[model samples]
Target: MNIEEYRLYCLSKKGVTESIPFSKLPNVLVFKVKGKMFTATDINTFDSFSIKCEPETIEELRLQYDALEEPPYFSKKHWSRVVVDGSISDKILYEWLDISYRLVVAKLTKKERLELEHL
Candidate 1:
């Protein structure tokens, strides 16, 4: 999928918000929930983007697909920045998005969870 499609997909999740936290890349859109980041994409150039993933599945994804550990910007143990080369299927990318959103949501405070439920 393209950058706009990817951005829309990420933002469609409950409580997810988009911002440009990385100053160096003004076009990079960081998707977060309750102030915690879960995924990101480059608006101007969809070269590659990062998503938080379960530690156990990180290696499996890397082995099975073209996914790789995120670079110096994010923790390698729990983040993988898959290159947007059109090789990875949209289904797998959506699953990664779900995983990232679930991971962040799972850490939400009880009140935050309730607020999300109301949204």
Candidate 2:
């Protein structure tokens, strides 16, 4: 999928907001709330895209989705960095992104939850 498609998909999720938190990569679009980041990508290039995933399902996803285990940047056991190049279908990619958005939203604080409810 393209950068605009990804941005719209994430924004469609409740409470999620897009920003550029990483100064190093001005083109990198970071999706977050309060302060936590759930997804991010470099709109200028499709080198990498990050998304949150369940710790237990990480390995399974890596096997099922052809994802790689890249840690330090992500939880290694939870989050994943899926390289973009048209290898995967847009439908499946959006589905995974929705899952990541929900997972991140679930961890929001009570105040944050209320704030998001208004949005």
Candidate 3:
């Protein structure tokens, strides 16, 4: 899918906020839930995005999908870079994005989660 599609999908999640926190890379848009980043992509290129993934299943996912790759600047074990080259379906892309969001939300502090629940 394209950048606008990606942005709208991410924003559709509860409590998600978009920001360009990096001054040096202003085009890199980060999507976060309750201030914790879940995924990010370069708006200028719209080529790929980095997302958090389950470490236990990450390698298997990489092996299963050619579009999945090591992220440029994130922990190789916990994050994946998914190339948006039309090699994968939009449904799979949305599923991966949902997983990333849920993983981050799962790690939120009790109070933070409660805050999110109320939001």
lDDT per model, in order? 0.84, 0.79, 0.96
Ranking by TM-score: 3, 1, 2
Q: lDDT, candidate 3, residue 102?
A: 95
**Model 2 residue-pair collision total:** 0
Which pairs clash (backbone N, Cα, C closer than 3 Å) in model 2?
A: none
Judging by TM-score against the true structure, name the best candidate: 3
Q: For candidate 2, write residues 1-119 as lDDT tens digits.
A: 88778888888877677888778778878998656788888788866688888887788778876644464466677788887767778887887788787788789888888888887
Off by over 4 Å in 3: none
Residue runs of model 1 more than 4 Å from their true location after superposition: none
Which pairs of residues clash in candidate 3, taking residues 3 or more apart in a chain or in different chains?
Answer: none
Q: Candidate 1, after superposition: displacement of residue 39 in Å?
A: 0.4
- The TM-score values for the models, in the order shown, are 0.91, 0.86, 0.97
How many clashing pairs does model 1 include? 0
Candidate 1 per-residue lDDT, tens place, 1-119, comes to 88888888988888888899877878878999989999887777888888888888788878887655555578899888888877888898888889889998888999999999989
Candidate 3 has an lDDT of 0.96
